[model samples]
Target: MDLSKYLGLFVSEGGEHAEQMARELLQLEGAAVAPEAIDSIFRHAHSIKGMAASMEFSEITELAHAAESLVGALRPPRAGSVPRATVDALMAAAERIAVLIRERGRGQQGEGKDLTLLLRGRAADPWSEPVAEAIPLKVEPAVSLRDRLRTVRVRGETLDELLDVAGELLLETSRLRELARQAREPLRAALDESVDRMHSRLRTLHQRVVAARLTPLSVLTDQLPRHLRDIAHQLGREVELSVAGAEVEVDRAIVDEIADALLHLLRNCIDHGIEPPAEREAAGKPRAGRLRVEARRERERLILEVADDGRGFDTKKLRAGAVRRGLLSIAAAEELSDQESLMLACLPGLSTSDRVTEISGRGVGMDAVKNAIEGLGGTLAIESTPLEGTRFVLRLPLNVALIQVLLAEVEREVIALPISKVLAAIEIPSGHGRTFEFQGDEAPVYSLGSLLEWKEIAAGSAAGRPVLVVDGGGKPVGLAVDRLVGQHEALLQPLAGPLGQFPGLSAVTLLGSGRPVFVLDVPRLLEA
Candidate 1:
């Protein structure tokens, strides 16, 4: 078997183990280091060392080997309390290892260096010198163990090819379904059932393949806490960053883009959002500031929220900054709501910081963050209060590859509407202007046929005409369709060339009959 294809799995595993070690070291900083913690850290270091050595990543293996020795020295039997100085050294070593792991993760071989001096305690220091011994592994792989091949790496392009092949298979399945529907006779029925089962199995496999391309949200946010710790110390504050739902998954492409923006947001939180320890105490808050990052699946979107318990936004300062920068007229700034003015930070070419600081001040500001998130088909919004804190929330679509689509006919053309975007389908109520009032809100209820430029040929020919009520920011509009054809699991295939520029269309799907059904872009239509 070609193990080159499996390089991604190895990288992902190594990154995960490195992150686990970082988290443990941070958590055990002041607490009595338990034997379990020591063993946990030791095992991670040992495993990483073995893996890196096998891969001939000398620098990574050396760092891991050093970490293992230190952790091993602390294991078990109240032999002696771990010296504060020793714990500090281990923490620094863990941080360096994390940086190396991240660099390797980004496809860079880390710079080589001997960290033995840093790992060793001074001769007179309380900590004992690391005991030297032969490498720990007793058995090695039977295959060629010494040769490390760097060329055996799979780029993301390989996965994209697999996805395209799956899309073609979906088109074939659609053709088979159409053929089955047109057949008549007992033999035809049996054939249709057999083909349908095959289609179902193929669909399942497609989903699994696409899902493997997803990376967890926690993976992107993993570095935040450690950064926050260092920033808190530098700024003379005490803070604890708690992250949950690190397991919520998103496409790797989206995760990579979001990680950079996440770093900036956390930096802003530490530098601007959180108050100093004394001020926090005066406000009847905990001496240590608290920052929390959470991820959760909400419908078809993955929501990531970063919140901090610190002095929140200074709305007055924000408004003043906007007016000074000439982004908003003085009069307009005066009339703006606190929330509205607070959003000015996200305006292009705007910065609230008066002077450049090492942490935050640069020409690039929240505007960059907003663009990056939106570029990923995600939205970024902020909520803050002066005395309370601030929260930046990002909502991103799960993946573009697959969606549960409800097929409906608009005039003579078939359109696939994402099931998540559809509120409900109902009969259009009788009204002039082709409009309807839903929940005391008036919205123009247009026929899907008219919307798609398909003039209705025959109205009322089909009983119980379906009108799909779709949401455009809480205001639901009815889309009258000739029929609710049925539902199917669809692999969203991108339209080719300029046809992709069509409005209100996100992608196209092939039905069981080999016919292309356009998938409605619900969000874009709502904007219209």
Candidate 2:
């Protein structure tokens, strides 16, 4: 029988099992290895092995069998902590199995060399077991049926299409309400009530659809511990990795975009932040350095922090490095405060490392991390205390597609300012404001019309034009607009083609009236 039909199932189920095993192997490295953890890992390996054998994937099956044997020996829990070497071997085997599964899914045959060497190397281990007799596998219908009922995985593209349809329906619903308001008295009242109910239902449906796109942060963070373990081993450092707020959910798309940036940050912590065991002990700290990755939601933003209690960044060294790298003049570097000096670390090709290594020291790390975070329409902040720790904070929008914005009329054009950036909207009295003082620092205020170079048609008095105090970087600036149209939920769409590279504008949104307005890129606009 052709096993091609089961390809999707194998890829999905096999991936989940592999992830589970990887997590359990990391846990097995702890001082106390739980029997349940071992059992869970064994079951996952056994399941994958059986599935691969059924599909005639010999490489994957052999690797899974080897992993299963190694884990099986740890099942009885009669020894000290699981050996680091055993965990490394199992992790490598699992990775190879994952690769083979992906290759088989692509209709490519595995070379089968890696598994041969891996198994041969493990053959002499005391825990190694003889290949067992094949047992006919039996599937329980009830368990299978219940699992099927529990969850269904849908492609992200399908959800995006559904959201698009829902958004269009919402727009049409808004149009109907507007039309109903203009109808004759009796009919107008009836239509208004009906439209209200319809609008409410549509809003509810839109919210649920948006919620469906959210995946817990744990889905991305679960593999991090294993990664940290590998990095620590490679660097000969003893680092303890802990993660919090794993249950916090954000858009799946955002998670995928930020994964690589987070990986780089974690690696930087291992290579540059965390000190070796002996150094950490000499510093009066624990032998195992502490690294914590935490995520949480604050109103419209998701705050992700990666903190390490190791050797924090040295601002003086950073300033010297910046000057040496020609990114800054010596006089300019000398004038920078501690905070400004620390920011120099994000400069490209500015490393303080005396020697180059595989992980870092080429000085291409932090700048890329900052760029990646900013590319997601987010901000990155760094805080460090020498010998205490270094914390990198990333503030990202909770959802990129839908945003709450303050709709304002700039001259004849309507523009959207993300409400998260708007601190307050106030009216400046005539002769009372050409600049707004915020926290004892005054910043020049510009009208939205002036900023866009659109002349006022009627030259109205500037007695009480609305001034929106907005967070521009860390400083607040006031933007004067003709009128505040009010708050709205806008579906953000990126500009395409020629307009894609526009500096001050990040995205466009369609209003309920089907009018498209540009969403200001606050940080970029401030820089410009």
Candidate 3:
């Protein structure tokens, strides 16, 4: 068998196993080292070494061999169990070996760092000694982190396929429900019960498909620490990057797009916001700068924020640059908020730097970040304080492949509201007082039927508009629609030609009945 074809799988599996071993070792460190932990580490390293040897990759084999030896030394029956220092050193060695293997798999040369030094350095904990009553191993079977780590690494195409299947199931369920509704007799009505069960099962399947597409942001943050190290070295600066809420899960597709966007944002902070150590010290700031990235789920959207403890935007200097470039009127520039003014840096062809530098300020790529993010149906907001720092927050929908939509009818056409954005559905009396009490204040409810000029509502053929109470930037408003149809899991179908340019619509989907339904763009509608 051609081993090279399996190289990706080998690397991915090896990396996953190494990570699991490291986590288990970390948990066992300082505490009584469990035999299982040592065995686990040894097995992982040994397997990697064997795999590399079989593939005839000498560098990988060597690194794995070193790690395996260190781990094997810790395995029991040698008059003592592993010591904390030994375990730690072994984990570090394993990490280095894992990186080398990964780089070798990518056809890059291994770092060839010596692992013998690491092992010898940790040979003596000096405190580890046999005790009269040895620490008891828990009797209950322990769960291995390796066992917990799933074997299958799902691909993007598989997620898309599952989404498509879920949508198809939804369509079938809807069709069956429609048939049951149109049934005429008691015998037919009895058959409808089976259809209802099928519908419920389809919903469950749809939920699973959506869940499978989600991945925690931590997966993407894995490389940021190394990246920070490289950038800090390049600039002769010291940076400590902290990450929070890495466990916050988002749709994998959104995570990928956000990763690319956030990379640019982080580079901007390192390249421009943070001054070198000497410069920072001269300016009375701390020698080491701090950059923090965090992710959290807010309502139906995922929020990603990257903040740096560095020099804030200089509005006066920005205004001067704008004037020099003739991009903004002096009067307009004076009125901009610091946050708003700082956002000008994101504008196409606008850079505060007078000269293009290698680090940043080429003036060509800033707008790409904004455009790429906005293209993903996300909003980017910038926050800055004079001496505090600057933060760029991005809000993205959880998933778009298969969406739970609040199905509603406009004219005779059904529409979908990404269940994420829909705050609530309520019935409002037609033409009642335009203002209603909300949050102790009067708020005006707009009619989607009227805005889109849905013929059924305009012609007064349908009942009172169905008002959907929506939270738009903490301000709640009601959107009136023709009538509420049941919710559906639909595959998002983008609009075609000029109709796609409609300010209030994001995507469209066809119901099982083959009827076209427009998915409401909540953000765009709120903007309008």
TM-score, one value per model: 0.55, 0.60, 0.63
Task: Give me the runs in candidate 2 sitting further than 4 Å from their true place.
Answer: 1-150, 168-199, 411-413, 423-426, 429-431, 434-446, 449-462, 469-478, 485-488, 494-505, 510-516, 521-528
Q: After superposition, which runs of candidate 3 have C-alpha atoms over 4 Å from their true positions?
A: 1-156, 175-192, 315-337, 359-361, 409-414, 427-432, 438-441, 449-465, 493-503
Score residue 195 of candidate 3 by CA lDDT: 73
Error of 2 at 37 (Å): 42
- Model 2 clashing-pair count: 0
Screening candidate 2 with a backbone cut-off below 3 angstroms (N, C-alpha, C), the clashing residue pairs are: none
Of 2 and 3, the candidate ahead on lDDT is: 2
Clashing pairs in 1: 174-511, 174-512, 174-513, 178-512
Better of 1 and 2 by lDDT: 2
Candidate 1 weakest lDDT stretch, 10 residues = 133-142
lDDT by residue for model 3 (300-392), tens: 467888999888767677777777789889898888877667778777777765567665555555677886676677778888777667888
Mark the 10 consecutive residues where model 2 has the least summed lDDT: 130-139
Which candidate wins on lDDT?
A: 2
lDDT for every model? Answer: 0.71, 0.77, 0.71
TM-score of candidate 1 against the unseen true structure: 0.55
> TM-score ranking from best to worst?
3, 2, 1
